[model samples]
Target chain A: MPPEPDNIPDAGQAEEIAELVAKTPDTLPLKRPATPVFVPATLPDEPVEAPENGAALENPPVERPISVPQAESVPSQAVSVVAPVAPEPVSPPAVEFSPPPHQTFRASLTLELRCATPDASIRYALGAADVGEDGTLYDPAAKILLTQSTGIAARAWVNGESGPLALAHFEISQPQWEKKEPLDQSDATPHEISDQRALEGPWKLAAASVRGKLHAHRGGWREDAFAHDLAPAADGTYAIVVVSDGAGSAPLSRVGSNLLCRETLAHLRDALTQSAPLSTDAQELRERDLPLLRVVLVEAARHALQKLNEEAAKRARPLSDFASTLLILVRREWNGQQLCAALQAGDGAIALWNDDNTLTLLGMADHGENSGETRFITTVGMEAELPSRVRFSIRPNLHAVAAMTDGVADDYFPEATRLNQLFGAVLPLVENGDAPGAALLRWIQYEKKGSSDDRALTLCWRDDAAPQPETVTEETSDGHA
Target chain B: MTSQLISWKVRDLMTFPFLSQLGITFALSAAAMSDIPPPETAATEVAAPENSSSDGGAPELDASMRRLPVYLVLDCSGSMTGEPIEAVRQGMKTLLSELKSDPQALETVWMSVITFDSGANQVMPLTELLMVKEPSFEARGTTALGAALRLLLDQINQEVRKTTSTQKGDWKPLIFLMTDGEPTDQWEDAADAVKAARVGNFIACAAGSQANEATLKRMTDVVVRLNDLQPDALKQFFKWVSASVATTSMNIAKSDAPVGLPALPPEIVIVP
Candidate 1:
């Protein structure tokens, strides 16, 4: 005899399956491919009541008479009556699903389950590895709605026997994204200025500034700026590399960073040529070049800050709106020694890598107690702090020197401890056969787990001309007043 | 001395049956009621809601990525019984739709809901965005905000992962708290504890005229005030919340700016 059908949902295929199974009372359900029966559009059907144990329901299991397509079986002239019998104490009942086991993850998905055995209690778990005692009882009246990717495991128990686990896995494919170009409402900065350049000089230079993944995700352009040029004076060739990272919160910081790097390099070149230097005695370098170089680097940084102020004034914006961190490095082989003068305001680092895998931090990264608290060059009175942040080093046999924004510094942060590993990562870029500039650009684009800020990296090292002749003569003996 | 004289006069007039029913005695009683300030401490400390049948925390999610834990602490007191409660239901629907459409939020954001009314309870635990079900809330009882704050502190400590030398932890949790009236429980201690924990970024909303903005100030520096209890204002609040959560989810893994929230609608004003 067929099981009692009073509690089965009156809507959808479940009701039709019950009557069809009643016709063949001796056979099991789900094994037979019972054709689906569709309800007429005109029936203002009475809704079934919810199960007594309401708290167990994760979803409202009540079935509403909704319209849908697909009529496979002959439209029944009227509802078929089913002869009822006491629920047979059968072993675990076999369960089947309407939609196949695999499904796609969306905002939400509705799933319907069918059981052929009589009086079987179906319980299910979602997103769980397996169903156990913690699974929710599946009330037949409700449909299972899945909102995210998950594994659904269901089982049915009849009398004392438990059925085998019925499992389904739904996966969400990568979403198709629409191409979006940033709107250039402001004339201050272009939407995209990501670029790379290779410079040939005493110092092999490779420089790149690229937008980060987070910015690209939201249609934002790169906010880092870098300018590297081999400044030539009468005495020697000086490789000046400047890198600036714009504040993410500042809308026009791209302009700020770009202007700072350009103006600082320009001013430093002019100041280096005019400052009666490079001709001073090498033994008295600290007394002569140190004091004069400090003024030159600080003045260049001040000039950059001044340009930002002028730009902010022209735009009728606050100076703070153009906040960025600036790092400047000037390297020259003067009198048989690699002489370097560097100044940093705000966060980021200027480091020199030695041949033995040791890295020396030329200028320190200014950081507060929290990771987010970073200094910017536009901070008021920042020029006053420049003299102290400036570092002068006259070392022998420098392997490589790198100037970077916080974007690169953050990957190896707690600056005190991570510089050695940073050079380890940076050391291999030049040997990649192509222009080291292009290689550096590709290197910065490499993905790190938590590093998604706009990156600006400028690496300068001695190429095949490492032992090149030091062509400097003591001439033009005028000294700065 | 003046209040004492008035009390004595009220007592003396109460002896006369005809005058006892007049405004003098009623006014005296009203004055006495007003004189007793709202209690700062509960006689018995309110306990965090235990994991009841429905008050279970987030179910196990099949995720290997770092989660962005977000908590919504709402006030469901007796005053929010009618239109206000219904508006909140609609707001949740709006918030869910907003978050689900946001690809970043849908990918990483995990959410939980805590409701305070006479006592605070976690209606839903930290569940993934896909598995998050909009909690059904009922309006009744006084605002036991202290219980809610303490419960939130406990829940965050229990659920949020911390980064160590070996593994990266979950991003700092984001909390959005909304209340429409003065708290009816001792909340100062809990507020102080929350302020000192530095465990999460908080956005406290003093959501109606009766809401104590001063009380919320102690809980967080980022406080927004709603001038009225209108449904439109509350709906805008929820929309702003959706935008903030979406923005945070995109930046949570990479950027290092202090939890930058999106701009609020005109209906809400920043509490300076």
Candidate 2:
């Protein structure tokens, strides 16, 4: 058969070849033993017997004994039996075969032949053999020829002492080379997060938020909000970043979320300016300055609530209509160490990415028994709930810290392992060419399962040297509240 | 918003030929099953719903769409043996056929059927609408309304998934109870249980003259009474049900608010 285009090996091609070879017959009827067989050069003086069906024998008429070498040098055990029949036409009909389930097939043919003379080299040529060395004509020593073509007859010429003998009657049926895909071992395990981002130094603050697809489809406004301020403290060392998320059910929650962000940063700034500088030691800060931080958070919450109530009264609505969650992160460099303090309410997460490629959850989202239900900053007794929700930490090797609303939490903090892997993937992007917040916003919006919620994220990091503030802020306002 | 709502209603009224073009067969299973606890002298028969015979046998499920589970708790007492029972069957078929044509309804609705006679039995388990079959009903024995409510509560416990801290579960279930007569068996205890379950929505429907509207009112805030058992009236009620389901699916897909049920058909009187 003519050679067709060689197929590129797939995952299952090796298995198919093994199976085919196992199914192939080891010996054909024409294959002789390795022992040498001599043919007398001289024939009897009687009239040479003509083969049946008007075919004449092509044997040499020399009258001497000839020693035929053993067939031990043949690469294959199959012997080529030259028949004196006319070559069949090489139409090379296209054959289509369906493979079994989970299996793929390629067209091929297996040729078996035997040559009789010592120098009886069998040269087989397949039609259209342009598919490289593997698809071209077989060498003279090749007794078994395999080609990737079907339904075309192969022409084989045996060169011997008697001269070239053409045997072109050999026809091959298309072989269905079956291959099965390799079994995947990772099917039963949870997906492993891939972290390919390259981290560098000199990071800046970036924040972005997008309205959810479902909300946009319903013509609803983007209720989620966030704000980050990196003003230098009086001591010229600390910076503050505040983030918030508004309740989707509340019509005025967006106002509340934005107000809380500004008010929280303002309150923190006032408290830091009024108070005197304390010890730079981590233990001293935890023991002495922690209570002061708590007071700052409570005071900020009170001011934010007062502002929300004034707005609600101005509009003749209830305060509950402006429910929102808050997250406050304070960072300062003390004694060559990076320290962070955070306070959070409701379903959003804060993660700290350290220089050693480890992620620590500074604050996990506050979730209720029911999914999508969580505590809000506007709860009746948020002041009392503040102590448990506030978090403080100090890390000399900190790279970056991020705070995100529940929309991003669905993808980054669905579980502990995913949280770590996600932070690892994003921390490097903090120093990437794309603005960190824009990169994160793209990552968050990349069609994830159960992520159709308003997303707001704030990323904060300190550069090795003071550089121009690389601040990126993105917001989407559909104009309907 | 008004135009969108009107468009959806108009689409609901217009029937499409795609219903017949769909290759899925609506083969009802005669066997009854219950995921609920059995009452004394259980007469319920449990078997798999016809569509669940093989995973490959039914149409593919769209995993992206959240399921809006609907339970139809029907009363098959002796009072509804003739015309009433026929109307119920026709109404159910009409509901299925209309919902099959609405792409949103097909994507989000999951339905199950429970019938109470001497005792309650789940004739069909909670199944996706794409594979749902029109349930068969036969009026017989007494109206064991209490037992049916108990079965429904139990089924809700087993079938409906509640949200947890880490994973999101199935949406809250919507239940509709249609009965033609007052309960012959004790039902007050079961009514309290249903109320305590805090199901997303419970619409009690009293069909025909013999049904007790007062008793149904106690079971749910939304109560509609069908004064007469007629095919056309029942068809309107079923159309209303289909519209309500479609609206709820659309609402939940967009917002987290409680499902807003559409107004009842004019033929059915709403009990204040």
State candidate 2's DockQ.
0.03
Per-residue error (Å), model 2, residue B219: 3.6
Error of 2 at A340 (Å): 2.6
Question: What is the C-alpha local distance difference test score of candidate 1?
Answer: 0.65
How many angstroms is residue A211 displaced in model 1 relative to the true structure, after the best TM-score fit? 1.8
Candidate whose TM-score is highest: 1
* Candidate 2, B124-176: lDDT as tens digits: 78876655645557889999999999998898888776654334445567788
Tens digit of per-residue lDDT, candidate 2, span A345-445: 77778877666544556663666433445668887787577665655555556777788777666554343334445554554555554555566666555
* Model 2 interface root-mean-square deviation: 26.8
Instruction: Compute DockQ for each candidate against the true complex.
Output: 0.03, 0.03
lDDT of 1 by residue, B1-272 (tens): 11211221333244323333222111112112222222222112222111111112333322113568899999999999876886786687678767876656755678999999999999879977765655667899999999999999999998887643222257678999999999999999999999999868899999888998899999888899987777788889989999999888775533335777898889999999
Give per-model TM-scores: 0.64, 0.57
Residue B189, model 1: Cα distance from true site in angstroms: 4.0
TM-score of 2: 0.57
lDDT of 1 at B47: 23
